[model samples]
Target: MEVLRIILTQSSANYKKEETILNKMTYPLPPFSTVIGAIHGACGYKEYHKMDISIQGKYDAMHKEPYRDYCFLNSIGEGDRGTLVKLNNKNFLSTGFDKVAEAKKQQGSSFREGTTIQVMNQELLTEYRELKDLLDRIKDFEENRVDKVLKLIKKRKKDLADKKKKVKENKEALNVVLIREKQIKELEKNINDRIKAYKVNEYEIPYSNFAILTTSLKYYEVLNNIELIIHIKSDKETLMDIKDNIYNLKSIGRSEDFVDIKDASIVEVVDTIDGPITSEYSAYIDYNLIKNECVFLKLGDKITANGTKYYINKDYVIEDNKRIFNKKKVVYTSEYVAEEGSENLHFDISSEKSYIVNFN
Candidate 1:
């Protein structure tokens, strides 16, 4: 079988594990889905093109890099407890926010009174205060004027119902009472709608623009000096397109993990081989292949050796507006050898160096 083989290098990279949060963990090699996604992105394909990928890579070292992670609350904090930030743009909680002020004392600091508070942006702080004042005024109007008017309207409707019974003998008087009741109902609806519009447009929308956030120092497990050997098995047209646009491949893991494509070429791979073949680099070997005794682990001096089992993400289907990822069970290790040939294992002999191709 003919396959597209690629060699890529990255100075520093982080293949993020989905479950980790505080200390962002890294995968030893990029998953199938990540590699496929990168290829699709490079090819600028809007739809998922069917393909199988074999990912094998090695990294020189790994280290933790510390960074500040800001957690934004759902709503702006009421009291002066958390950090007050004004979104550079309004109504969205995003990274592009200016630090308006922060409480110096974690518990007792008053941001509004400027007591035990550190003011970062004076203009934004003033705007926040103005918005707060407007919100207060809106609340006062809703409580004192809107509520009072609604109460009066309710009482008038009740009184009209009673008056209608009294004027039942006279048709004109009864009609007048019914007409007034309808007019009062319409007026009440208009007043309620206007108040709602004012609260949302004038106060809530503008006031909520400022966000409350808490920050914590977190670490990201980053791999350095990563080298990846990837094989793509697809249709002839797809393989040719990939080889033609191999240079368009930017990054495999994170956007910041820029990849330098070292080589891209079409190579002949065979599934049947007589002699033993050992993996030159670390790879995500299929768990079933290892479990079924088709692939054996190389136990050097140690009594026993086994690779780490990882249920890595491969492909996904969209369900209920969420990506439901299909996972592949695989063993991640370089110490693996296929003594006897298996259907799933293949050998690449096109180049001077031989490699065991294990596709998941």
Candidate 2:
């Protein structure tokens, strides 16, 4: 048996676990579909191409940081918003202040008379957008309100020209600004404290503010110069195609996250002294997994990044467009003897469904 092995390195990367919002997460290693997609992207195949592959990698270290981004989906440009309003005008209800005008004309002589009238109402319309977008707009409004209050406070503080004379005049505005500032500051400080706590405890932090958080954002965990190795086993033709394009692979996760491919080549396998069956070979066990050979983990059907399994199989199923584990099989790498222990698995064994595998 001949297998293609590829080694890749990435400085910083995010394999986002899309199921979580308000906070983002990453997988320990690229899943099967992500790997398949990267290969297809490099090979110029627009659709899924059947292949067999296994991935395992080690990162020097990783840390999470809050990232701000003004994403288009969450925001609207002025012109774009206006155009959308005009295009979707009919959906909104009429405001009470609309102006109504009526005109009537009467014509015709002795024998018969005809009367015609027309009524027109001019209205002000507001379009409906996503609830999130509406909240963003409200957030923007509050931010502006706070900014104005802050500026007023600054002006009042410097209104010391007449001392006693200006004191009473600026008193109300100064009081309003000071009160708002205190409220906003208190909220912001508490949020910051929560962020600090998350860092210390390793919990998911949140993004919210009394002031409009103008910046678009995401949460990311970074991996520094990590080594990623993948094992591929397929027919002669499929293997050849993978070999041709695997070298061209530039990324394994998001487009911006790139891979530094150090090696992409096929290796010859040596057989056992007793037989020609080969010392090592890839075997896939899926839907037909023995009753006690496999275990599936679900958080009451709620999907998450950690413990989400990825495996290799002949058929495929995609979950949330990112999870591509299709009843795939698990392989034993350490001893291959498959006794009762001392084997390395692509997935961290979570339960004792397979006694040969260990769990954390």
For residues 1-360, could you state the per-residue lDDT of candidate 1 as single tens digits?
A: 899999999999889999998789999999899999999888988999888888988999999988899888787654676789878676456648888888877677766677888888999888888887887888888898889989999999999999999999999999999999999999999998998898899877777777887888999899999999999889999999889988898887788899999999999888766776667789998888877877776765322327899999989999999999989999898867775546667878653677878876
lDDT by residue (220-322, candidate 2, tens digit) is 7766666766766667777788888876788776787888888777764322223111112212212222224332222344222122233433346777887
Candidate 2, residue 16: how far the Cα is off, in Å: 1.7
- How far residue 200's Cα lies from its native spot in candidate 2, in Å, is 53
TM-score of each: 0.85, 0.43
Candidate 1: how large is its RMSD? 3.3
Question: Which residue segments of model 1 deviate by more than 4 Å?
Answer: 81-83, 91-95, 159-177, 300-305, 317-322, 340-343, 350-352
